[model samples]
Target: MKTQNFKTITLLLVVFLTSTSMNLMAQDEQERPRRQGPDAKALADKRLKIPDLTDAQSEQIKKIRVKAQQQTLPIKNTMREKRARLTTLSTTEKANMNEINKVVEEIGDLQTQLMKHRETSRQEIRALLNDEQRVFFDSHMQRRHRGKHQKHRRG
Candidate 1:
């Protein structure tokens, strides 16, 4: 009877630990931000729904996106490292304001460069579009931007 009781308690403890770990893992996943790839052409295609995209134009846009992604990847990686360092610095007891400000400025510069690259890519894609397609693209972009802001507000 003693052995049976011990076995049952052990089993209950194991199940409880397993469930607790799973819940913690799920929470960790929810806390992490979703990583976006630089290209994200599929997102554009889905959102814009540009009709009658010629094969040639599609290829050109793909090339443009891929090139942009390639150029930005290194910069993005460096920015990510800087961000991690900033986070560490901010959490320390003796946080250095000057160092934090410098990192923030660097991040802002990297973001500006990224925005410029994105705008250039958008122009390249827009050049490929017809008048009607361009209009659709513009509306799609507005809607996407509004949705992003709304999400932030709600969240």
Candidate 2:
């Protein structure tokens, strides 16, 4: 009877430890979905091919990206709403091409504005980069742009 009691207690303790560990791991995953380690900034800089990036340059690039996002967010939101509007207009019993066309034009214009802003931001970042860094940055950006824009179109 003592041996049986000992085995049962050991089994329960093992299960409790395993359950607690699993919960702790799950909680950690929920808290950190992205890189927040001390080396995260260093990794990002390396990925950008600017391993020797200065703090000032990093700050400047960050500002440019943030500013561009701020300026483009409204345009993007409007575009999304316009797209929904276009879908609604086109799905009617008597689809109004005229209204749909107007929404399309507005979306196009917003896209143009966004592209211009992005170009400006890119130019600013390029201006801050050295020749070698610029070469890598430009190529990287070109590849990114192609990947982003060509996702919907066949080669």
Q: What's the C-alpha lDDT at position 41 in model 1? A: 59
TM per prediction: 0.69, 0.71
| Candidate 2: 10-residue stretch with minimal lDDT | 42-51
Report the C-alpha lDDT of model 2 over 13-55, residue by residue, as the tens digit: 9999999999999999897645677888766666677646788
lDDT of 2: 0.88
Residue-pair clashes per prediction, in order, are 0, 0
Residue range 1-155, candidate 1, lDDT tens digits: 99999999999999999999999999999986555786475666554477887778778888998999998998899899989989998999999999999999999999999989989998999999999878987887788889999999997
Model 1 has a clash total of: 0
